[model samples]
Target: MALPERNNEGFLENAWQWDKATAEVIAAESGISLTDDHWEIIGLLREFYKQHEMSPPSNRLFVKAVKEILGEDKGNSIYLMQLFPGTPAKTACRIAGLPRPTNCL
Candidate 1:
């Protein structure tokens, strides 16, 4: 499928344009291979956006949300860092086609 339009940071310009294929393209551009674990986080991010109309504004908040939904083992910063590397909240939101977190650099 043709890729959707994306911003300079590679986030989908229109959130509605997001899909698994779009996410794959974005992740590939970032040199990430999307495993099932990655998909779980992506799904969680999307659901969070749907409910809150925004991405988590910080790693602490993201981790807390994950912990509430997915439990401590998968929700910690270490697991997220391993999955998205660098800034986990920013990278995951980008790949999930959500807006960048408010306070992220």
Candidate 2:
């Protein structure tokens, strides 16, 4: 399928255009396989965007938010980093089809 327009970093230009197929393509580009674990976090990020209309804004906030919702076992940096290498929040938001986190790099 023809994916929607994306930014230089591969985040969807319009989040409303996102879907599972689009996420799969983007995750493949990032070398991610999107297991259930990944889906759990992606769902959280999507819901967060739906409610707050923005990404977590930084890795710290991402971790904190996850901890708040999913608890420490899933929310810690090590766990998140394992799922999304480099900057966790940035990579995750990109794959989740949300706008880039404001304080992420």
TM-score against truth, every candidate: 0.94, 0.98
The residue pairs that clash in candidate 2, if any, are none
Give the per-residue lDDT of model 1 (tens digit) for 1-105: 787887787777788779898899888888999999999999999999999888999988999999999999998999999999989999999999998888887
- Regions of candidate 1 where Cα sits further than 4 Å from its true position: none
Worst 10 residues of 1 by lDDT: 7-16
Q: Which number leads on TM-score?
A: 2
Q: Report RMSD (Å) for each prediction in the order shown.
A: 1.0, 0.6
lDDT of 2 at 88: 93
Of candidate 2, the 10-residue stretch with the lowest lDDT total is: 21-30
Residue 24 lDDT in model 2?
93
Residue 99 in model 1: shift from native, Å?
0.6
